[model samples]
Target: MGHHRAHVSQGHERGGGQTHEEHSGSHGHGGHDGHRGHDGHAEVFRRLFWVSLVLAVPVVALSPMFADLLGYTVPRFPGASWVPPVLGSVVYAYGGRPFLTGAVQEARARKPGMMLLVALAITVAFAASWATTLGLTATLDFWWELALLVVIMLLGHWLEMRALGAASGALDALAALLPDTAERLTDEGSEQVPLDALRADDVVLVRAGGRVPADGVVVDGSAHVDESMISGESRPLRRAAGDRVVGGTVATDSTLRVRVTAVGSDTALAGIQKLVADAQASGSRAQALADRAAAFLFWFALVAGVLTFGVWAALGDMPDAVERTVTVLVIACPHALGLAIPLVIAISTERAARAGVLVKSRLALERMRTVDTVLFDKTGTLTSGRLTLVGRAAVAGLDDDELLALAAAVEADSEHPVARAVVAAHAGDTPAATDFRSLPGRGVRAVVGGREVHVGGPALLAELGLEVPSELGEAVTHGQQNAASVLHVVRDGAVVGVLAVADAVRPESRAAVDALHAHGVRVAMVTGDAQHVAQAVAHELGIDEVFAEVLPADKDAKVVELRERGRRVAMAGDGVNDAPALTRADVGIAIGAGTDVAIESAGVVLASDDPRGVVSVIVLSKASYRKMWQNLVWAAGYNLIAVPLAAGVLAWAGFVLSPAVGAVMMSASTVVVALNAQLLRRVDLDPGTVTGRAADSPSR
Candidate 1:
């Protein structure tokens, strides 16, 4: 039975498989537009706060409450009483406008939030103070309280908006990577043109230290390209003729002529920008839960305020009822609750980027914490994706070095991957070969040292009717079982030796797998390679599961199958073929060197093509989730205790919280939430060491 069939049941879509562009286009604008409006709103609040603070000084000095609290007599003046009302009205009109407008919008949407609660609190104080001034009520003057409340709310919102603005600036930073101009090559010479003017097939000249104008293949010259901004690979990659280069990547040294393949929105940089925008804009489950809680709190505070007014009015007077109601609303505005998750998300995302992990979805980051299995793609992920000589077996009459030298001399004229592997394996110099001739379905034949020799696979062996001698039979079987392609080297029509070639495994692969196991996450590998090839790689890395011979289209089915079997799977890959699988997993992690389509489908992107980045994602996800929970609990706990106190629950014991004191408590709770979210920055995300040991060696 197939290994996947034994472990996986049936496939079902669990709300995964959405591409980054689809998620971004659907949700990106709404969030950024909201943030832009918040930036404008922040500026308004900041200005209003400073002005209101100045206006409040005279209003508080002129009030009886201020004189009584500070043991000072109000200066006698003809119009001092009017000063308090005039300045208090200005503070309410200017400083409280944002809350009032936000509350109106929230009410229209039929979803009141912190804005509505704040609006209600300040409006109540305004009405009660004006009623006292007009001799319609016996309430103590609340003009000083009203001034302080408006200023404080404005300050809180201003600080919150600024923090969010700074976090969202990442999108702007990404877009700024593209240069404004390009050196377009024409028949006469090179001419600088606007970046937008460069079209597909346009040849562009890229100088040393200049950025690539568009995604293209290098047609001439060579250079070391710095793709750190796009892929998070700090080392510059060497690019020669026919090698592909991405737009926004810098050529560190040497000049090149590139044939543009893509420009404008089609470039990889544009795709990354869209992904970042989408992730920042998309709302996560935690954020949605917080929203629901805030909405519920709005209704809860409204009902509590109403009850406080009714109960106090029945027991005391209208003045006492209004005072208790205003305090209740002020204390239960949901400011902390509203800030809990978004602050954590903003800080974590910024930190993730610094560590070369790009979070494309808040929901993905949250889901990463619960991932039980991490499925890795084999080619370009576990292996180097390049052929290399793995082993050599020689007959009793010949040594291993002699066998390799003979094969290399014959295959040196060939350009096939297997030929290159043979030539690379022979460290010493090779004797000259002559009359080289290529076999159509077999391998190559040539004259080396005036002796006829042939090199090929099983097909050549069958063609020549050559049987492997007993001495080399066991080596051939072992090579075949381990998925290494065996090449037979024959001289004078006699089989003399065998050379095994395979895609070499990366040195980091073993360490990466061990690290995941240490973290209690099951490691699995999926590849389109044959069963033996996949099994061989899985065994070397100590992978728990292997899905071999999987077609690109069926990769997602395997992911869904794992999910159906109750596994929280994270698929990591680096190719266009891996796009569907990347989207189908609970969390998709794309290697930086992967195609743009795969990156677009993934929720998290590892800037470097390093599997250890998978470990970084887990570390960041768990740390971020912990901070979110801490802030949530603290915010919710603060409300549980402070709201009741503000509603006069301890009034019989001669203790009551004034509106100013309640405002202070509310602001303090917000500050605590902000500070707790900031603590996520302290998490160590470097993946060079795993479980306190160097990740370069897994055995240790």
Candidate 2:
């Protein structure tokens, strides 16, 4: 990552053999590492700044120019003149070692940039000061300027390194999600072994509260798995003998014997790591452009330095020529330019991680600000992906709660989604049912309080030749039009109530849509659901467009069509079917406890199911882009102004800029960039902050 020998990646492998070297290697170039690599760069710069600052004090105090400017004598003493040169040389070799070596490497690579410019300035100043100290020239001494320049440059770099260190959480934290050892069920009995010993078809025993060692299917036993880390679902899911379990999920309350279906690189967790590594491998366009800017500045300063010396020499003032040339080169260092994009990227990544957003692709983050349309998958993304009780109607004699209690008791032993939804919705104590029997497609029949109760759909009613009363039919007809699942509570051969189980649109979806509308971005829904069902959801959320009954294979074509119409599009989805479209869009976002295959294809992955996480992405992209441009403008503009002044272009106006003053301008420009980037951390991304219509909105 550093492009320096001190980068120090020991190649430690953990969690499916992903080595730290692979992680560090993806960090782009020497300048914009993007905060994914290395550990001690900030400490190195911090140490250099303090040591250089200390040595600079003696050099500055002993300089005749420094004492003259302050209207004080140089503490006249024997060998005092030797003090500035001696301390100044020590600062150049020790404090400027990093720049000196970096400049050499850049020269060998046939490229000139910030490091070369910095090294040239200090080296020239060092030579000129020594020449003057030895009586070659009386007025070219610049020991104080050289000392201050090195100290200030080191301080700027120290702050830049520290900012990057706080970026996205350490990759080691991802590795720690896996256990070092696993319990393998062998021919004799269960035995403890390292994770590497695991292979396909190997049976492993997972105890209560233990993480699954690898992705596998439950061969024996059952448990409610806490998969919030893997799927972003808050509730624990029950995994029986046939359910699949991902590696990194915890078995919360019981034991499970699993047959490993995947291990090492084949595991789902390993797939997530691969997606991140690939994203980092694809470098950023802005980073490359900044590097080129530094290259351009390098050549510009070199030509300026050469021309300044030639012009001043033609006037027969060689002492003035050397001083002006040194000033021109020193002021050309691109400290702010080198730090601009990297600092913004670092802060953006930090904020994204806190908001449960994983930026798999840097380009996606950069492009989100320009997206004009966001197309979302309807089933699991905009909706809750599970049936929820939304409506119920009862006969005149029966209360709604009474009808609900009867249906819940009859559906208690069933595993159907509709049955589960009904049972879960009951808040009161459920009276025990007797003689429970599954009626297959018709429904479930059981005896509760000596009454034969049946809970089912229209098929159950048809078999019994029953008709719903007008009161229940009103609710049933409305629910059917919206594609909700309707079931009847038939007790004592009489139809009493009808309950509606629909794919509940998440409460956050409405706010998510409203926020997008406020940003002037059109919200669109893509679903395989019927037209009426899709429009029902679209109208409720104030969506601008809808694409219903769209087959999964055709979803990519929709994204392509949007692009064809000259609008930037973003696709958000979470199914294997959504993978193609996620890859086809300009910015692909995988949201809402997404499937692994979808994450593999998406540029950004939201670990939480909150649809409002989409708003956070747009907010981050626009804010970070604004900072990058601001820093670049200030850095480039400062050089344009400072370079001319340093070259004595203002000499006719009696206002020639000195080297110490140029050094201050360079350091101040860099500090402004760093501090401006830090402001991004203050942005609130609570998922409610942007949606003003939401009750939980926070201050901007």
Window of ten residues with lowest summed lDDT in model 2: 4-13
Regions more than 4 Å wrong, model 2? 1-37, 66-78, 168-282, 428-454, 458-467, 480-483, 490-494, 593-598, 690-700
- Model 1 Cα shift for residue 242 (angstroms): 7.6
What 10-residue stretch in candidate 1 is worst by lDDT? 6-15
lDDT score, candidate 2, position 201 = 92
* Clashing pairs counted in every model: 1, 0
TM-score per candidate, in order? 0.80, 0.79
Indicate which candidate wins on TM-score. Answer: 1
How much is the lDDT of residue 218 in candidate 1? 92
Measured on C-alpha atoms, candidate 2 has an lDDT of: 0.76
lDDT of candidate 1 over 645-692, digit per residue (tens): 888899999988876667667767878887888788788665565334
lDDT tens digits by residue: candidate 2, 495-607 = 98998877777777888888898898998988877677777778777788898777788999999988899989999987367889999999999875322533667888876
Question: Which regions of candidate 1 fall more than 4 Å away from where they truly are?
Answer: 1-88, 129-168, 174-194, 197-213, 216-228, 232-246, 249-261, 353-356, 389-453, 467-483, 495-498, 593-601, 684-700
Alpha-carbon deviation at 447 in model 1, angstroms? 5.9
Q: Cα lDDT for residue 115, model 1?
A: 67
